[model samples]
Target: MEKGTKFRIIKGIGLAALVAALVQTGRPSLAQQQPADSTETKQDVIRVETNEVMIDVVARDKKGRPVRDLRPGEIEVYEDGVKQNVTAFQLIEADSAVASSSEAKSESTVAGGTVREAPRPLNSLRQIKLVTLVFDTLGVESRRLAQQGALDFIKTQLPPNTYVAVFKVGNRLHVLQQFTNDRKFLEKAVERATTASHPQSEDLSDKIRKSLEELRQMGAAVGAAGSFAPPGTPGLVSSGAIKSGPPIMSGDGSVAMEKPDPVRLKLIEVTLNALRFTEDTQRASQGMSSMFSLLSLIRAQGDLAGRKTVIYFAEGIQVPPSLNELFRTTISEANRAGVSVYGVDARGLDSARTMRSSRDMLVAAVNASKSQLEKGSDVALSREEVMSTDTAESSLRKNEQGALEDLSISTGGFLTANTNDLRKGMGRIGSDLGSYYALSYTPQAQTYDGRFRQLTVKLSRPGINVQTRTGYFAVPPTAGAPLLPYEMPMLAAFNRHAPGKDFEYHVAALRFGASTNGVRHQLLMEVPLKNFTFTPDAPKKIYRAQFSLMALVKDKDGRAVQRLSENFPLEGPLEKLETSKNRNVFFTRSVTLPPGRYTLETIAFDRATGKGSVRRQELVVAPVN
Candidate 1:
């Protein structure tokens, strides 16, 4: 009810099938409008801020039924282990399919020194359920199962207050529908999402199979070749290709070695190159594009009110090591926005193909070992040893699913994997979305130190369970949310009455073709390397520079529409340090905005020296032709 209030809701109900049907509510309209595809009349942007933090507590008894009658005195809130005073309390309940406005029960209790009744009606509290169904690229079989699972969930008839949106994640995040309770619109969106699988996505499995075959071929070539010489000598060659006798002594007492076959050497080189190509292909198959699309969705959801839930349906979310930072950022943003991601592995009842593949590879290895043994090669491997090895498929599957688990569980949600009955999983998720106890408190630590503040909710009663987010960063709230560390500087610069040109930098806002979503523009910031301070690590013989670049795009009315931020960690050999100072660092980011004129404020801060530069530029986005 207040500006800048931070709300934390406990994790939603248990697993169930996803993308269900919903009915309209008697509460205030929480349905969100879809983004305009074409340029039209301008609409002013409004933002609200709050200083209070709200936590949604779900207390259940031994029987797993919600404990609805708990009083504020019976509950204790702790932030960073310090007990906090409860400022406001309310119970938000999910309306039944046939329930009317009058039948819904909304209770409120605000306490300072004494508890008092709420002055506003239940609908004014804006206690509504918001869910977004994101369908990632899937294989043919997975698409079928996912579609059916979503359709079944929809037919179950969700709560009247539950509003749903549909999106498809591929090369980009495509919104099929905005927030709505209408079953027809949601159904149509799901249809399009299910049928709109990326063309290349279906070929992903084929590509992996081909890559594996290439790896097998390379492995065979390596096995066929005898012992390898050290570097600088001839590489792998056919067994016995070299002389089996001792080295011949020359007249000068030098040992002359037999030359290796040129054709064999060429084959080895080709195989090695193929091995490298296969490795790169597998890493690319880990779905970096999908991860970025998902990030875009979470960041955009930060602007919405209350806690949001994302039902992410994908065959599997494989996050490679290189994308670790991006994955963490995705989770961090979701936690900040109070979004719980429930990942549903669409590969229902995964076939035993993985196990079969492992078996086949092992068999080939055993045959090759037998051939080597027959040839009296000491390098031959034992069949028993190869058979004793664990199946790599099991470990690989666990690793592939680890990303999904971490992404979901870190944000107060769970992953449903290796299950054929997606309907059951969605049913649990649906129940979790039902309702919870809303508690508000003002944190005692007023300093926005950008550090994580641990949160724990304790109940005085026994045999009761409470579920909520683990913690939140101690950042001051703005626009109903907190500005991230990298974002804080950009906003500060935008709000300054006078620009501080601490250093020299060039910025360009280049406009591109217009699309349905908005006009595409590239924001580029260039700064001389000499503008930043570099610290030299004598032992490592490298120079390091730390800094960040950020920008804020504000409309004509002075309301911020978009904020971009990025950090640069520069390091180079000491020999190149001087040369680097003569070069410039360029940063670029693409953003889409409605066709209109706006002011772009940019900042470049050197973290090492704590020095920064601020600049302003005017940009215009022409409407679509």
Candidate 2:
């Protein structure tokens, strides 16, 4: 129990009662109050469809090295060019199943005769859904020694069922932490963001002298209270007194000058037009709306489509170049929602003397305030605006490494740099998320013309290198309706890792025990109902089934806390001559949970040949002691 002390006693007694039981049973208001013919008989029995394929494979090794092993029949898949047939094969194996379940319970109690009790072990490894951690602290000026090495590299390389979240842009974008897995509340939110510094030039000269004393007390309370006026204030006070009549003061004249209160000068001209929304423009618009609200809350928490992984961590910069089409439509909707984006440069773990003493204290405070405004003195910026703000901060550090290499090549994702060798870039992102491999197919262009299709994954034998996700978007057949096989396996379990599209109906498994109405929790599913097959002789047969289940209760650094979802019914029995012998079926549900670790997901469908399947599992619940 030392994976950081069972992730801090299961994240301090089950993450707030499993996030209040996953906001009371996994949302959609308890699957929209059941009936509607039980949600159209679970969307006329499942009909899942998902796509997100970007496996660039080239793991060389004729002596090339990157050949970590290569399986799934030595890999080979394609799409827009055709070739298919690799049904399903997941690799992702970074070892540590809690140190291989404590070395198989210490080699089974020293090979004794009574220490039995195995069961509880099935989260099938591969877990890393977007654990982003970018705390460059905008060139760290010691903010507690760069927040003690970014909270000791997020409490020593976070992992346990991982879900971590943190954002720090410096000069603005702060969320210090959010998608927690609670490494001591993300190490006290990186020690309360090491008292953030480095907005430099003396923190933008104390934010432009607190924006000119809050714009001169908001233009003297909008010139003595004219209720926030300003829609052509007499055409800006008749073009400033038709060029000069409002201020005639001479050598100690008793009436020196007073006409300036058009409602406290329009509340100091709208508080200096609301300090043009500063704080580094609200931390680059709250770090791009907290990275698209943590990718739309991990795609509305439906176990992020196919095999997901986000990892981000930044230092690279693309903040508002109109958010590059919202970061290429959020990495093309996280590659059609199968998510995958690994970047981690954190300014390549800085420290070239903390980036040359924070660029030599911002070029010696902009060359001593441009040599005191080129000698005229009272410097409020000029000397050609401090040499054009040091040439736009040297072109924003050379366009932040080409905007983190175009957001890690438009999201197929992979860019680990520096951070004192971020553990060899998180061990090459945990060996490319554990020897990556998951190929799917089935896109004979079947309508859904939403556009972008292109994909290619091939490897009949050359040096492997496929990294995945290049194109998707097809989606349209009137946006494929007629759902009910449990809403077509929860909408093809939200696109079971799309690409070519057949990755063994996206598998997800989990189970837990201790019944007697206490800590039960069972969520077993074996999707893969593909087009509802069965034909011995058929005459008037009509079978379409689908299913979807969700269960949550996370701790151990995975967050969530608790949730549950249901929508099953893949009915059977329709024969005129023969073909209804209950072709494998099973759906069960029970939840009592109180103790710990829980994450159960199931999505299945077979809407008369549309295809759908997904299964995920993880249950622990043991603790009533």
Q: After superposing candidate 1 on the true structure, give the runs of residues whose Cα lies further than 4 Å from its correct spot.
A: 1-50, 60-70, 95-121, 124-128, 177-188, 197-308, 315-338, 347-400, 445-452, 473-483, 493-523, 528-546, 552-563, 569-584, 589-601, 615-625
> What digit string (tens of lDDT, one per residue) describes model 2 on residues 546-610?
33333334566766433333332222223211222212223333445566655444444443444
RMSD of 1: 27.0
In model 2, the runs with Cα more than 4 Å from the true position are 1-75, 78-82, 85-423, 426-442, 445-458, 462-625
- Pick by lDDT: which candidate is best? 1
**lDDT measured at residue 427 in model 1 versus the true structure, 0 to 100:** 75
**Cα error, candidate 1, residue 54 (Å):** 2.4
TM-score of 1: 0.55
Cα lDDT, model 1, residue 356? 52
The per-model lDDT (C-alpha) reads 0.55, 0.40
